[model samples]
Target: MSRSTFVATIEPVSTCPVNCEACPVSRRDIEQPKARLMSLAVAGAVASRLRHEFGVGYAAFGNWGEPLVHPQIVELLAIFKQVGIGSLYLTSSLSARIDAAALVESALDYLDISISGVTAEVYNIGHRNGDWERVEGNMHALAKARRESASRLKIGLRWHRYRHNEQQFDAARELAEQLGFEFKPYFGHLGGIEAHEDFERGTLPQSKRRFIENSVFLEYVERAVAAHVGEGSCPQAENLIIHSDGRLLHCCALMDSHKTGIDFLALPRRVLESFKRAPNSHCGSCLAKGWSGFMHSSKVDHRSPAEVAAELAPSSAS
Candidate 1:
């Protein structure tokens, strides 16, 4: 991401209680201490930096953590709004105990829900921490709240698919349609090829492997990828991510991993500039041919979730 505009993404926590089947990283995977709530003071510190230094007008509370888990999430949103950056976008698994009405009342422009499947078996297979009945109930309540409140908050459904639930796409899409939300299909890579070599080798057929690696699939999917990229207006140009340790980063995707790039908060702006100016070879590896392809990397980069909510100015209906 180039330029100096700030879009601070705060990751106050990590890992889901449910250990999904396709997930490469769960709360238990990290050897660090248990996920704890971020102190309001820490949130205030990052918010201060964002407003004063970066002129960041957008704040998103989801990245590595299940954002809804924050006890004062509503207060945090109110603080951002009080500071003139309330146009926040929330990304969550909807696993927290908060009410959907409260989330809708926060005046957040976008409420993106991570949903794996509709059926209990399929959904539970990928979302170990999820309860189909509970999520369904919450989502229905959310939709009702949106209608009654007449809020412009747009709800989005993101589905992470793998071999286990590949057959549930139709049902997933139907659920999204039923909810009047857009559905995004994400294919997850189990990190390094060697890490999940046995799993991948066993699950992905030769034909599927060919489709993913083939140049034709890449070309076919690039069109849709371009459209999605265009909609977000390239996050790389306007995004910034703030880690719980008080470090700011160019992209949330790069967070927790030093191999992606330097931490902007820890380094000089010049260093960030130099890093962004350097080529991102990994982007080339992201061909966007299949679901997993998009999850990998891609040439079409965009702003961070923070920047997207701020600069992109999500639609009132979003």
Candidate 2:
């Protein structure tokens, strides 16, 4: 008999190394709870089952927390690789300590390093309590690992823009390129600054509406941002973000109480079907309050995950 496990966008640890002005978890200034890391045994069992059923490269590793903070991360990855899981994908704040040797040797196929500002003061404004030098050092270390291993790992950096840090944009992009990594810039969510439920109303609040209108971030990633949110937003009613535990949230951005997700493993197929079929209350703001777009959840985006993976995978053409 097989001991069962379930696949999810795993969060091995529920801790963020750096506090940001826009992150909901970090906004609790008074008596915030400590971070929670998932049980390695639980993660291993799920990964094994997914590997048995779907083969390698079928799961994503990071969602909300810093996966690098898990003390046994190397071993955790080794289990998946042992079972033949392919192309582990993860994104991080690059604020956590990195084990370069372990990371390069593991199953991590893709890593997206997040940066908010280019200059020290400005970068700290968003990254709060972060050290620019340390982040830069980690970036170099990751690049070094890729070079030394002659590995197939792909690394990229994303800069989430804000009004205060707009001046540092070009410099950061240039630095990322010089470091031999892809540089992407996008506008960030403003809802985290207020009550998490505020955005759930599906319509913009006057303050947030005004902020979006004047934000420097809007000028940089207008089209991309629009595609993901606001008018003509991409429909993601089927997409959900899963926590280290089995808890799920409707949209990646919404973490409030209204749209409580069904435990993925408790009724895996049913939950997944529900996840794939309809829009929930939590996604209203992300769809720009358009009920019509919400109704389009079952519509196909015309690309499957496998197709996306193949596109990103190195060309096998000879």
Q: Give the top-scoring candidate (lDDT).
A: 2
Using TM-score as the measure, which candidate wins?
Answer: 2
RMSD of each: 10.0, 9.9
Question: After aligning candidate 2 to the native by TM-score, how far in Å is the CA of 207 from where it should be?
Answer: 12
lDDT per residue for candidate 2 within 1-318, as digits (tens), equals: 353233336667766777665555555532332467666666676566455642334456665567787888777777666777665677888777888767877777778887878767878766766778888888888888778887787877787755555567678778888878887765554533123344344454444444444443332233333444455443343343455565555554444421465564555655555664565554445456443332332221223324433543222221
Off-target runs (Cα >4 Å) in candidate 1 are 1-4, 22-24, 27-30, 191-238, 249-251, 258-318
Off by over 4 Å in 2: 1-8, 29-34, 49-57, 82-84, 191-240, 257-261, 266-268, 275-279, 284-318
| lDDT of model number 2 | 0.58
lDDT of 1 by residue, 1-318 (tens): 334465667777655565544333442333432466766776676676677666787777776667777778887777667767757888887876777788888757888888767778767655766777878888888888888887788998876644354457667777888888877765433423222333335654333333234211233234434544423123444566665555554444432332354554456666665554443543322322232233335322222334323533222222
Clashes found in each candidate (C-alpha, N, C closer than 3 A): 11, 3
